[model samples]
Target: MTDLIPALRHLLTLAWQCDPRRLLRAAAMVAAGCLATPLIALCLKGLTTETLAGRGGSAVLLGLAAAALLVLELMMGHFAHLAYFELGDLGEVELQNRLVALAHGRPGLEDLDTPRFADTLALVRDDLPRTRASLEAALQLGGLAIQLGLTAVLLGLLDPWLLLLPLLGAVPVLAGNRAQRLLDTAKESAAPHQRLGRHLLDVATGHATAKEARLAGAAPFLLARHHREWQAGTRLLGRAHTRAAALRAGGQLCFALGYAAAIWLVVRQAQHGVSPLGDVILVITLAAQLSLQVGTAIQLLTVLQDAGRTAHRLDALKPLTPFHANKSDATSAPLVLTRGIRLEHVSFQYPGSTRRVLDDVTLDIPAGTALAVVGENGAGKSTLVKLLCGLYRPTGGRILVDGVDLAAADPADWQHRIATLFQDFARLELRLRDNTGIGDLDRIDDDAALSAALDAAEAAPVAAAVPGGLDGLIGRSYGDGVDLSGGQWQKLGLARALLRRDPLLLVLDEPASALDAAAEQTLFERFARLVADSRARTGAVSVLVSHRFSTVRMADLILVLEHGRLVQAGGHRELLDAGGLYAELYRLQARVYA
Candidate 1:
C-alpha cells in the first residue's frame, strides 16, 4: 500500500505536468461514467419494483428514467475514451522527446555503453509512452471503485444480507490480481531472451550482414539460434498463462455458484412475502454488477501499477536539465587555439573495467603541426579521440587547450571548434546537400560554401553523377535515392568534416579505410595541403590515426603507440633514421610494397 501510493503519485504528476487540461477532462469523464453506470441499476430497480406493484404511472416514469440512463452511459463512455486518447497523444510526444533529450545530453557516453542502461533506454523508447497514457488506467480504477461502492449499497438496501455479494466478489478480484502479478514477473524475466531472439532475426535479414551470412551459409544457424531464444522466452510465459487460466476459472466458478445461491434465497424470500418481487429483482442486478466492478478494478489496478513502475524507471534516468542561465565558461564563444593542446599524464579506463585504454599518455600538439598516430588494433586509438573530443573525461590527469582546461569548458562549445571523420562515420541517408551541410548546419543552405566543401573532399565528380546534384537523396531506403560505394561514402564523410570551416582541431581516425592505396595517398595529400593552408591563418592542428605507413610518413610528427603506451614520437625522417620500434614498423610496412 505504501509503495502503491508513491508509484501512483509519480504517474499522476507526469500526466498533470505534461497536459493538465486534457488529463483533467479525462478524469471528469471517468467520474461521469462511474456515476452513470450505477444509475442504470437504480433505474432498472425502480422500474421493476413499480411494475411488480402494478403502479402504472410510476412504471412509465421509471422506464423513461432507465432509457435516459442507457443513453447517458453510451455518451459518457464515448467521451471518456475520446478524452483519454487526446491526452495520450499529447503525453506520448512530450514524454518521448524528453526521454530522447535526456539520453543524448547525459554528458558522457560511458553510461550508454552499459547493458543495464541499454535496457532502460529500450524501455524508454518502446514502453514509456504507454506508461504516460496510464493516467487513463488510473482514472478508470477510480471509476471502478465508485461503481463497486454504489452496487454494494443498492444490494444491501434490497436485503441487508445481500451486502455479502460484494465480499464474495473479493475472491475473483484477488485471483485476478495474483494472475496479473505472475504475468508481469514472467514477462520481465523473458525480456533478455526476447531481445536476443529479435536481434538474431535482424542479423539473419540485415543487408550489412548478408554477404557474410551467405558466404558462411550461416542463415540456417542464425534461424535456429533465434528459434531457441524465442522458445526460452515463450516457455515461461506459457506456463504463467496456464497457471493464471486455472486460477481465473476457479474464481469464476465460485462466483457463479455463489450468485446462484443468492438468487435462490432472494426468490424464496419474495415468495414468502418477506421481500417484494422488486427487491428480489434489484438483488439479482446489483449482485452481478458488484462482481463486474471488482474485476474491472483489478484489471485497472494492474495497468496502473505497471505504468507507475515504468515511470519510476524513467524518473531515475532523467538527466540534469540544461537551463538557459547555466554558468557559462570564460571561453563561452568558440575558442581558437594559439599554442596547441597539451595532454599531461592522461590515463583512461572505461566504467566498470580496470584496464586503462590510455596509460599515462602525454603529448604536445603544437598549433599548425600535422601529427599522425600509428598503432595496431586495440592500441587505444579511438579512446584517445573520444577523450580529445570531450565525449569522455579522462580518469586521471587533464587535457589543456593552450592553458585552459578542456573538461572545465562547455563540451558543445568545445566540440564546435573541432572536426573529425571516424572509421565508422554515420551514413545520414539524407539529401546530398543536407548530408554535407550537417557539419555546419548554420550554412547548410549556402550553395557557394557547399560547393567548396564538396570540391575540397574531391567529391565533385560523385555529386555531378547524381541527377539533382546537392538536392538528390543519397540512400536507397527512401525516395529515388542512390547508395554510394564504400569508398565513395568515405569521401562524403570527408566532405562533411571539411565543411567545418575554421576548426581549431581536426582528427581523422582511419578516414580512408574503404579507399584503395593510390586513392588513399591522393586524399591524404590533398587533406595535408588543405590543413597547411588553414594552419597558415588559424593555427589549426590536424591529427591522423592510421595503420598505413605510406600515409603516416607525410605527417610533420609521427606518434607511434603500442598497447596503450607511446613507444616513439618524432618527425617521419627522424623516426626512420633512428633504429627504434617506429623504424622497425616502417620497414615491415615497406616490405608490403616491395
Candidate 2:
C-alpha cells in the first residue's frame, strides 16, 4: 500500500497514453461515486445521533438528509460503474492494436519462437483485456477507502477507544492479501499443465490437425493427454481457491469478534454513564459500515493487484519501447531505395548458438539486376533474405542502400520497399483479394492494381476458379470457402509479393517449387516481364532462390553459396567455365533432366 500511488500512477499513465479524454471522464466518475459513499455514511451517522439524542435537529429533517445522500450514493455508484465499463470497452480496440504492433515490431521471429516469450505474450493477450475491463474495481476501491475514513471519524466521535475498531477490522484483508499470493503462485505453477492442456485440445479438435488425428486413429491418445493436463491444472487451481477461501473465512470470524468487542465497549461506557445513548447508536452504525468498507477495500485491492501483475509481466517483455506509438517516426518512417543494396562484411549468429549462420560475406545487388542465390540446405540463403527485408538486423557489418547506412534508414520505410515470398508462406484466412491486397496495404482497395498484380503472378486462373473473384474466401476453415492446391497457393503468395508494384527489392524463395515444368516456365516468364517493367520504372533488384538450375540460368547474375560463404559469383556461363560450386551443382541438376 505504501507504493500504491506510484504503481497506480504508472498504470494510469499506460491507460492515459491510449486515450486521455476517456481516462479523465472515467476517473471523474469514479471520484464522484467514491465521495458519495463516504457522504452517505456520515449522513447516516448524523441522522442516528440526532434521532437518538433528541437534539436541536428535527428527526424528520435528519431522516430526509440521510435518505437523500443514500439516493445520491446509489445513483453515482451505478453511473460510475457504467461509465468505467464503457471506458474500458472503448479502449479495448486501441490497446489490442498497440499490443499486436509491439509484438511485430520485434525485428525477427527468434523471440516469438522462444517458449518463454510465447507464454508471456499469450498471458498478456488474455490479461490485458481483463485488466482494462475492470473499471468497476477502481471506483469501488475508492468508495471503500473513503467510506473507511468516514467510519473512523464517526467512531472517534463516539469515543476515542471506538476508533480502534476499524483498524482491527483490517486484519482479514491483510490475511486475504497473503492468501491471494497463493492463488497467483498456483497459476504460475500450473502453467506447463495449462499449456499442455491447450495444445492437446487444439490437436484433437482443430480442423487441420483433426484430420491427422482421426486418420492415424490417435484421437484416444490426444484425448487422454488433454484429460490429464486439464486435471493437473484444475487440481492446482482448486487447491489454491480452497485455501484462499478458508483463510478469508477465518478473517471474517476475526472481524465478527472485533465487532462484538467494539459493541461491548460502547455498551459498558453507556452503563457507567461515561457515554451517551446517542454515542452507543453511532458506534453501532460505524462498526457495521466499517465491516462493509473492509470487504470493499479487499475486493478493490485484489483487482489492483491483478492489474499491477499484468503491467509487470508486460513490462518484463523485451523491447517494448520499439512499439510505443510516439517512437514510430525515426525507425518506422519509410526508407527510399534508389541505387542498390550492398552487404559489407555481413554476418549473423542466432542467440545462444555459437555457429554463425552468415560468415563475413560482402555482396552488391545493383539496381535492375536479377540475382540468383543457389545453395544446399542450411547455407543461410533465407537468413540473408530476412536481413535484407529488415526481419532481422545483422549482428556484424552493415547493409548500405545508395551509400546510406541501412541502420540509419527508417526501418518501416526500408521494409516497405522490399517484398518477399518465402518457401513457407502464410495461408491467411481472408478473401481472395485481401490475401494478395495486404501486400500493398496503402492501396489494398485498388481493384485495378490488384487485378494487375494477379496477372503478373500468373494467379488469374486461381481467381477465376473462385465464385466471387476478388471477394471469395480462400481458406477451408472460413465458411464454405474452397482450399487451394500448393501450386495455386504459391501463385497466391506470388501475387501478394507482386502487389507491391514499385518495390525496390523483390525476394522469391522457391516461388514455383510445387508447379510442373510448364507452369514454372510460364510463371517465370511473367515474373521476368514484371521485373523488367519494375526495373525500368524504379531500378528494382530481384533475388531468386531456387534449386532448379534451369530457372537459375535465366538470372542476369548467379551467386553460389556454400556453408554460409559465397563460393562462386558470375553469369551462368562464367560460373560454368569457372567450374566452382555453382558449376558443380548446376551440372548435377542438368544431368537429372537429361
Candidate 3:
C-alpha cells in the first residue's frame, strides 16, 4: 500500500502531463459515474415506496429518475474510457522515453554489465508495455472506491448495522495484496529461465544460426532445451497462482457469509414490521453493488501492485550513476597527442572476479606510430584495447594521453576523438550509406565523405556495384535488400571505422578475421599506410591486434603478450633476433605457411 500510493501518483502525473484536458475530462466522468450508482439505488427505493402508497404521479417521476441514473452509470464509464485511452498511450510513450534516457545517460559502461542492474533493467522493460493498462486500472480502482463508499453511506443511513458489509469487503483487499506479492515473487524467480528459453528458441530459428543448426542436425536438441526451460518457469508461476487463487477464494467466501447474514437481518426486521419494503429493496441493491465493487477493486489492486514493483525497480537503479559523476576534473580530451599514449603499471579485472585479466604492465607508444599487440587467446589483448579506448578504467595505475590523465578527461570527449573496429562489430540492418555514415552522424549524408571512406576500406567497388549504390539496403530483413558475404560485411564495418575523421586514437582488433589470407594482407597494408598518413596529420596513435604474423609485421613496433604480461617488445627483425615467446610463435606460424 505504501508503494501503491507513490506509483499511482507517478502514473497520474505522467497522464496529466501527457494531456491535461483529457485527464480532467476523464476525472469528471469517473466521479459522475461513481456518484450515479448510489443515486440509482436511491431512486429505485423512492419509486417502490411511491407506487406502494398509490401515488401514481410521484412514482412515475421517480421511475424516470431511476432510468436516467442507470443510463448515467453506464454511459459515464464509456465516456471516461474514451477520454483516457489516448492519454494512457501517451503516458506509455512518455515512460518509455524516460527509461531510454536513464539507460543511455550514464557515461560509464559498468552499470550496463552489472548483473543486478541488468536484471532491474529487464524488469522495467518487461513492465513498460503494461503502462497503459496500469493507468486504466488505477483510474478504475479510484472510481470503484468512490462507488463502494457511497453505497456504504446509503446503507448506513437506512440501518447502521449494514455498514459492516463494506468492512467485510476489506478482507478481500488485504488477501489480494498478499496474493499479488506471492505472484510477483514467483514471476521474478521465473524470469531468468524464461529469458533462457526465449534465447534458445531464437538460436534454433534465427537466420544466422539456421545453416549451422541444419548441418549439426540439432533442431530436436534445441527444441527439448527450450521446452525444459519454458516448463521450469511456468511450473513455478503456476504453483504460486494456484496458492494465490485459493487465498483470494477464502476471502471472498467470508464476504459471501457476511452478505447472507446481512440479508437475513434485513428480512427479519421487515417481518417484525421494524423495516419497510423500500428500505429492504435499497439494502439488497447496495449489497449487490458492493460485492461487485469489492471484486473489481481487488483485481485492479493487483495490476497497480505490479506497476508499483516496476516503479520500485527503477528507483533501485538510481544509484548506478555515471562513472564521472562526482569527479573534480572534467577536462576535455586533447586535440592532438604529441607524446602519444602511455600506460603506467596499468592492471584490470572484470567486475566480481579476482583473477586479473591484465597484470601490472607498463608501455609507451610514440605519436604517429602503428603499434601491434600479439597474444594467444585469453592473453588479455582485447581487454587492453578496451582500456586504451576508455571503455573500462584500469584497476591499478593510470593511462595518460599527451601527459594528461585519461581518467580525468570527459569520457564523451575522449570517445569522440577515438575510433575502433572490433572483430564482433555491429551489423546494422540498414542501408549501405547508413552502415558507414553511422560512424560520423554529423556527416552521414555527405557524399564525398562516404565515397572517400569506402575507398579507404576497399569497399567502393562493392557499394557501386549494388543496385542503389550507397542508398542500397544491406540486410535481407528488408524487402529488396542485397545480402553481402561475411567478408563484404567486414569491409563495410572497416569503412565505418574509417569514416570517423581525424581520431587521435584508432584501435583495430582482428579487423579482417572473415577475409582470406591475401585479402587480409592487402587490408593490413592499406591500414598501415592510412595510419601513417593520419598520424602525420592529426598525431593519431593506431593500435592493432591480429593473429596473423604477416599483418603484425606491418606495424612500426610490436608488443608480444603472454598470460597478460608483455613478455617481449621490439620490431619484427628485433624480435626474431631475441628468441622468446614471440620468436617461437612466429616460427610455428611460419611452418603452417611453409
Best by TM-score: 3
Q: Identify the candidate with maximal lDDT.
A: 3
Residue-wise lDDT of candidate 3 within 43-62, one digit each (tens)?
Answer: 88898899999999999999
* Deviation of model 2 at 15, angstroms: 5.5
TM match of model 3 to true structure: 0.93
Per-residue alpha-carbon lDDT of model 2 for 1-594, expressed as tens digits? 432454365456655776677767766766665566555555665666676677645767767776887777677667766666766665566657767875775656666755666667776677777755445565466556666777677678767877777877778887677777787778777777888889898998897689999999999999898999989989999999999989888987898898999999989988999876766766776677777778876776677766666666666665743522453445442233467878999998876578889999998888788988999999988888888877777889998877767666676777788878999998887898889999988768998999988887888999999889899989877588878988898888988998875788889998888898888999889878877887888788888999888887889988888888888888989988999788788789888888
Model 2 error, position 339 (Å): 6.5
Question: Against the unseen true structure, what C-alpha lDDT does each candidate score?
Answer: 0.79, 0.77, 0.87
Residue pairs in steric clash, candidate 2? 334-413, 335-413
Compose the digit string of candidate 1's lDDT tens values, residues 459-525.
Answer: 8988997779899899887777987899888888998899997888888999889998788878988
When sorted by TM-score, best at the front, the candidate numbers are: 3, 1, 2
lDDT of 3 at 214: 78
In the order shown, what is each candidate's alpha-carbon RMSD?
3.3, 4.4, 2.3
Clashes of 2: 2
